[model samples]
Target: MILDSSLNITLDNSNNAVFRILGEERFKITNAGPDIGGRLQFSNGRYIHASVQDDPDVDELRFKASGHLDEPLRIYGGSNYNKRVGIGRLSESPSRPNEDMSRFGLDLQDTGNGYLYGLRLTNDTTGTGGSNGACIYYENSNMYVRNFTGGPIKFKTKGAQAMVIASNGCIGIGGITNPMYTLQLGFVNSNSGGAQRHANWNYLNSSNNSFKQLNGNYGNISIFVGGHISINGVIVCVSDKRTKTNIYPMNPVKSLDNLRLLNPVHYYYKDFINNPSQLQAGFIAQETKHVLPTSLEMAGQSIPNILASASYYVDSFKNKIIQFSDFDTSKLELDNSGNFYPYLRVFDEENDIELPYWITISKILSSNSIQIETKEELPSRVFVYGQYVDNFHLLHYHRVFTTFVASMKEVDAELQKEKLKTLELQREMNELISLVQTIQK
Candidate 1:
């Protein structure tokens, strides 16, 4: 039956109604009307457009299906137009949706100018619209995981937060949520619960809080929480024969002569100046550089202008002192005056030797001319060496030890020569005694 010129309906042998458009089969309704279960099938290249009337109660265009809808309803397009499916707004362009609506979902844009050929998970449905949300997108051969809000991106495992990348670009591993540095590793508890476990690169044991490196053949380098460090194997420097050019044996005698110029001294650091019990034995880099220049390196340092003065004075306690008038008292630690203690050296004319004294800031007599006290009486002319200063001469102790070994070897050789001379003298004395006894016979 042809009700309209464009629509044609025909009844099959099974009494099913088949509808066609322009004489072609487009829709088939099986099992007829009044049946509880019926099937509506559409042909290829056919579209079913649905829309709800402007009723307050009806808000959706829903498709009711009796069985499971296993495949998705796909929209096919020709070469004339781009295919796009939007939930919030009907987008004219394939790249983004209409700017008026807040669309949030996945968008596979296929445009030339904006977001080219990739998948984007965006909140605003545009290329650059989200401000308070995060997006994981791929654009122009690059993939980006960006967070516009001031929050962290966390990665978890087994329902526990394992790692976090903070908004400030700090990465924290092993359940570290708030990292203060560029890369921080958190401490994790081991199964034994005896020590805290770190990442797989290193293991930190509980005893002395020793941290040891992993995956080394010779054994690990262990560094304790305190100042102690231990190496399991011999430490070898890069002294390969192929890397060297002009190498020669060092002169042991010359090294001994140079070593004699270095004066080893027992002194306390400025922090321990008041106690005096925590004394350290070392050579002043400035003095040692003249003897073994290779063992010293010059580095830039800053010092307080008050301690840089060359003036000296004797206090009433027979101690040598230097007073500074113009200085920031706030910068100078008044409670811990020993930290600013200056090392003073005086030449004793009677003993014909140089004596060292530690000078401490005893009194803060106003901003002008603060008084200082020394541990011993200083001579009229004294040389002051201030540790708190700019441009320090730092000593490389490994090279210093090498030079000391050369010097000691030369001393041992000289002792061997003296013993040979003593033996020769004793042989001559024995011969002389034997000849005198022959003359007496």
Candidate 2:
């Protein structure tokens, strides 16, 4: 059936007209002219509203409307416009037969006014036990969610939360429910090695921060820069004494005696091209190890290695009673197998008690210069032990100052005793001269 009219024609009193081709209304102009708004026919069941002026040559479709528009104008895929499908911005006109501008996605831009988001994507399916939330899913797997307004970004797996960025900008990894730190990892198995975590940062194309943990006993956190690490910020490595074990009592006097062996010298850094002459007072690790062998180890080794071997070296001698009555250097035979370190035997003058203490040896460095030949992570090159890497200079100076103060106190006491003895001797000589004069008279 076909109908063609040149003038105003209406098939019904409801002011509706339809033109059909092949039993389908290919074109429908709903209202009268000058108020024209309806669907225009495009091939493959696609239609565009007459309210939009679309240029197919450039893939541009713009809405042309007069006066104030409604809150939102939604364009859906089907005839009812109920299901939500993303709209793509075309680079060229789709109406043109020669041009194929087919790109499917949404483009959101923010110009000003701090508009939270230009586009919001949401999936609200609540009745069938599915959560009503906003998420981005790929390959049938829900990956991430922008759940709340101005809230943390979350990563999820099958609706189970795996990670979150807190509102205060703290990041949490693993199944960590609460993230109270800058970077936190939790909910890991005690012996699992499969769930390794890493964070990488490149700063100014010069410095890099990297961390990798292969279980609790093995891991490394490295921050490096062009063969040298310069930390502009404070780095606080936790040093709670409770984490340590088998700590022996320290002898500050023995420490003072061993410290005298260190060479105080003026030197320049060989690692840098612009070398500056500096004054330094410390022992070389290899040299000091010869004198205090039990106190030193390689840079990467764990601390308190001597404690682990102490029982093997000292346990047998604990039960035996040995005494040295006289000093005879010629008859003494040293045991080469025994580990020897300095111990101070002090008699407390004020308390009248015997105090024996092992020296608190401050292990020094073998190499003070950075290795300039390589730009890789070198754990053996960088040295740190018990929070005293760059700050070892301060500890060495403190030992020097305390030793000076102790020596000054001893000198002052000796001078006072000598003055009193000299006065008494002078009085006795004067009394003897007076008796000799009386006998001569």
Candidate 3:
């Protein structure tokens, strides 16, 4: 709202009212226009004007005509002019636009204080020639505006930079000043040397306040050291070594690369020429990357060399394990070597148990399709001797004696190797000691 001359204004039954002075209002709203129950009067030389807007139930501007209009009053916004001199309707206050984006509704201005408290100007048509076509300026200063019910301040940027509603002191919102905020979209903020939160993804051009959405290339919401921001959504946040932010862009892992790594070969039948120890049936190591047996030149073999013996291959183990349930009942295969292979799955479970033996498995075939299997106990539940993958029912038990014997064998092998090395070292030391003694004599 623009205030040029001095005037004594009295309004009745009005909603959001503001007293404009000089600088435009983009700070905040703390004014609800006088709730007049009688007629309104405007004194002094400056013309009495009002920009009345609002919904059907909301009285834009109303004045008791019976009251005397001893002064001239001009009503544009929701200003109630009973009978006054030089009474004229300047323009209607802008209102909430419809979905078609045809017209604009209201243009909020400062009422002396730095806030959008009351309606000062209204551009009805809101098209090319509407009064709301442009905007009012609100510099950063200590302006105070009050809201009756705290009607939300609105914004629409044709080519504006950023709309910063600022204030020196903490903003105050009366009941009416704060209206019903539904699933609508717009920018409402109060910049009191504090944070500036944009509504509907609004942004300001670093140069000026042309009030527009964040369209052109520029950074979005930012929080600084003295600044703290919080957003709740299906938000994607990222923090580098230094800065932390709620929004960033990352290239999603594409299936093209994963497809290249996937193999149609049976998961269990993977052949690893290198690290023959891990490839052995009972080998228990973690994280092995088996370059799924390709027809490529590797392990001293040409392209067509399917069998390369005496090759020192390195097969990195993986945490992947076979779950009996992963194999479709009809898909389970029994090879001619009397081995049944089931499909592997990606169930989350800790697998750290290791059995020393060859991890032998036994299956007993019953007459009525019942099957029981047993295995030498291993550290993890990776293989169920004879149980299906579901619910982890009972399989045959591991022989306690077999496990004990396996442990003993491992200990004996280590001891024998150490003993041989110790003997050889002792012999060498004795020879050195004899030579030292002869030299001394």
Best by TM-score: 1
Provide the lowest-lDDT 10-residue window in model 3.
300-309
Writing each residue's lDDT as its tens digit, candidate 3 over 166-210 gives: 222222222112223222123333422322333233455568856
Q: Candidate 3, which segments miss by more than 4 Å at Cα?
A: 1-90, 93-104, 108-110, 118-441
Candidate 1 lDDT, 1-441, residue by residue in tens: 444564545555544445433333334444232211122344331223232234422222212334423211222122222333443212223233223232322444434545432333445555463465676656778877767666788899999989999999989987777987678775535432322444334466778778665533333232212122466767655566987798887789988988888799999654232234476798898888888888887543322233323335665775444543333443553214445434223334444454554455565555544456655655544333223332455678888788788899999999999999999999999999999999999
Which candidate order results from sorting by TM-score in descending order?
1, 2, 3
Clashing pairs in 1: 301-390, 301-391, 325-369
Number of the predicted model whose lDDT against the real structure is largest: 1
Clash list (residue pairs), candidate 2: 56-93, 56-95, 56-96, 58-92, 58-93, 59-92, 59-93, 59-94
Over the full model, what C-alpha lDDT does candidate 1 score relative to the true structure?
A: 0.52
Model 2 agreement with the true structure over 255-371: per-residue lDDT tens digits: 545556655565544423222335534555556554455545432211211111000011252321111222221222212353222121222333443323222222211222111
The TM-scores of all predictions, comma-separated, are 0.35, 0.34, 0.16
Q: How far in Å is the alpha carbon of 33 misplaced in model 3?
A: 30
